[model samples]
Structure formats: structure tokens, C-alpha cells
Target: MPEHASGASSKLIVESVSKWFRTPRATVHALDSISMQVAAGEVVCLVGPSGCGKSTLLDIIAGLTKPDSGHVLADGHLVTGPGRQRLVVFQEPSLFPWLDVFGNVMFGLKLCPELTNDGRREIAHRFLGLVGLEKFERVHVHELSGGMKQRVALARALAADPQVLLMDEPFGALDAMTREHLYDDVQRIWRDAGKTIVFVTHNMREAVCLGDRVLLMSQAPGKIIQAFDIPLPRPRSIYDVELVGYAARIADALRGTVGGGVPE
Candidate 1:
């Protein structure tokens, strides 16, 4: 568990952030004057069309990639490089093939080297249980299903005790039925663990179901064009009538961005 839970400041500030990708033919502006603040322990989802720099922005926030201008601040300190404080959970599980479930999770705790082996084991077990995978701790990665592989990944990230969790379409590849199950699990884990989360996805309903606020990014020169606050109760159903309405609005907004047309 994190040292601070509720009321602990895990705020993230993106100040005038911008990025560009240079190619032989052209220099593409990936992000433009992006700025936003994510409150401590709040779940914020980034939703946009295919070309929008959603993943690029996430990499910047994680310090995995450097921005051409501006900076990201976690709890008032600038983020220069990847650190344990801000961990990224990618679309792929990226687990070691030879490592079993328990070993894969323990690998995340390598960020906390000061802890004894037993301490790390305890943290690993606790988080695996949190993700409802305690019984399969010793199972090999190949033996697990796609959903279960992601569960281990989630546990590994949580066990690292990162103040901010950055997820890039973590469930985008899953089947619809599996994704619904994860929606419930993720919300429960976020509520109980109390960590600031920035989730990036193309799925509007996924954003509506999981995020407290959904940020819509425009195409190519990605900019935050709209932000919708989801005031619905937690453990939101993807099938909820009201939630469907919210998703529709966001989807329309995304379409407008993609087509370069005015929003309906």
C-alpha cells in the first residue's frame, strides 16, 4: 500500500507541455500547449481519435519520453525521468515469459529495493489478492487468459506503490465481456487503493464508466478540446442508460475532432 491514502497529495501538473516528432519528410506536431492538473487520487481518462497524441502525452507524464517544451510536476516536483512514483501500465502485459504470476509481480517491487525479501513478498501477495488473483499466484503467464494476464499487470503496478498510475488502453484488446468484468475490478481497486490515475483509451463508455473526468483530445496537433465530468456513482455499469448518453456525447465529440467538422 502507498504511504499516503486519502487526503495524500498526488496531484499532477502538466504545464504548457508540447511535443514534436521529426521525420525526413516532415516535423509533426504531436502535442500543442497541453496543460492540465490531475487532483490527488482522482481518476481522469484521456479520450481522443486515433491520431491524437494521447499515448505520447502519457509517455511524457511518465517521463518515458521528453517533451520539446514545458514540464510535468508530481506533487510540485518536476518529472525528468521514469521513477517508481509514477508507474505505467501499458496495453500489453509485457510480463516475463519464464516468470510465474508471483515472480512477475515481485519484479515490480524491485523499485523498492530497501525492503527485505519477505516484505516484498507480503506486498506482492497483498496486491495479487486485491486483484483477486491470489489463488493463481504460482501459475505461469502462458497458462493465464488475457484478462488474467492484465490482472497480474495491474497487481504489479499497484504493488509498486506509485502515487500516480498511468494506463494506456490497458483493456483495449480484451473482449467486451472481459472488459466489463475489469471495469468493476479496476473501480474497486482504485477506490480501495486511493491512487491518482490517468487512463488513456479510445472507448468512450470505458472512460465514462471509470473516470471521474473525461478529457477529449483533438486530432494530430493534440489539444484538450473538451472535458466532461462524470458525476455518476461509482462501480458504473457500461450498460447504464445515463452512462450510454454520456458515451454518445463523447463519441460525437471525438467524431467531430476526427472529421474536422463542428460538433453536433
Candidate 2:
């Protein structure tokens, strides 16, 4: 990891942000005055139950959804709308089936109109190589496996050179074996790229493996109840005994939140 990866500089800030959704039948309070800071190049994972608004908070940070009150800041500037500097990778690959891998990655360059056609192509190739898809550049999306499709999506997002990557369960749909493989790949990418990452997942072991800090959230009208600092060494493994101990501790905290008890 680079110096930036472990440095203590704040990158993204959420200040007392709250959100609500009003329906014909009832109003759903999604978030309740949530606030936190992410260090530049740090990997932070948000873990909670289904209705705890983990994804909702991710969207708000991506500028896809605005909060009902308060606001978010990126590098001291207020985040009003989506920008290339902040990009999101959702659970679904959402790739364009009509385009080949190279073209699909180049499509993301649309957000960066400043680049020339040649520059975009070069960048596409670079990121594809970074994600170990250099040989699959001409493959169509439909021909790729589930994990391969996600690698392409990841390549596309990284091609844009986003400073902050918001991942909402990017590997949730993959098979156990595939997901385990991706866990290593993602950590390598994060370490080499040195970008701040905010990952949301329901998997406690995944969070413990990937995050420098794991934040536990309360049930709906979600608020962060606990932040667990993972003191284990880098390049963690899901099966590591020390890592499993941390996951068990986090799981207990999660259970408390879900059971209407206060989080430790």
C-alpha cells in the first residue's frame, strides 16, 4: 500500500445527514442524522440488516440521492450532484450487452469529455489490464461470466479515475467461490490505486476482510451504532482465525442492533 492508503487525511465527510421517503400509505425515514468521515485512500465498510439504509446512504454519497436534511462534503466542497470524481458500482454489473468489453469501458469515458478518442482508448486498455481483463477486451458482455462482468464494470469505473469509489454490494450476487476470489482482487486493486472506498455489505466476514473500519448500523431510520477498527495486518483472509474473531465481534454487535438492543 502507498502512503496515501494509510495516511490520516479526511476525504469524504457526511454531516448530520438525514433522509426520508414519503409514500401514499406511509413515510419511511431512511436515515437519521448520520455522520462520519472517510480518510483518503482508506477502505470503510458499512454493515447492517436489510432495512438499515446502507445502500441509501451510498446513493446519497454518490450524489444520486439528496438527503432530507444536512449535507455531504468531498474534500471540503459541498456535494450537490454527481460528478466523475465520485462514481458508484452497484451489485449488478449493468453492463451494455451491445458493446464489447473495450467499448463498454470506453463508454464510461463519456463522463470525461476532456479526453480525446485516442486517450480514452488508451485509458480503457490500462484499466482493463489493471483488472486482469486485457485479453478479454473484445469479449461481449453476454459471453462473460458473472465475475467477469463485474471485473468489466470495475474497469469501467476505474477508467474514469474517480477519487472516491462507492460500492453497494458489488459482489453480492456471485457464487461463494467467485466472491472469495474477488475479495482478494478488490483488496489488491484498492491498495495499488490508493482511492477512498466506501463499501456496503450485509456480510460481516466480508466487511472484516476488506475494511480498515467496519461501521455497524441500526435498523431502519438507520444510524451508525458502532465503528470497529480492524487491527489485523493487510491482505486479510476470510478464513484467518484473527479475522474471524473480529467478524464474530461485529456479528454480535449487529445482532444487538437487529434485536432492538443498543449496540456495543
| lDDT (Cα atoms) of all candidates against the true structure | 0.90, 0.89
Per-residue CA lDDT of candidate 2, range 1-264, in tens? 211222246798888999999999999999999988889888999998888999999999999999999898888889999999999999999999999999999999999999999999999999999888999999999999999999999999999999999999999999989888889989999988998899999888899899999998888899988889888887989999999889989888887667643222
Worst 10 residues of 2 by lDDT: 1-10
lDDT of predicted model 2: 0.89
Model 1: residue 123 alpha-carbon error in angstroms: 0.6
Which candidate number has the best lDDT? 1
- lDDT (10s digit) by residue, model 1, range 1-264: 111223344488887899999999999999998988888978999988887999999999999999999999898899999999999999999999899999999998999999999999999999999999999999999999999999999999999999999999999899999999999999999989998999999888999999889999988799989889889998799989999999989888888657653221
TM values, all candidates = 0.94, 0.94
Q: Cα deviation of 258 in candidate 2 (Å)?
A: 1.4
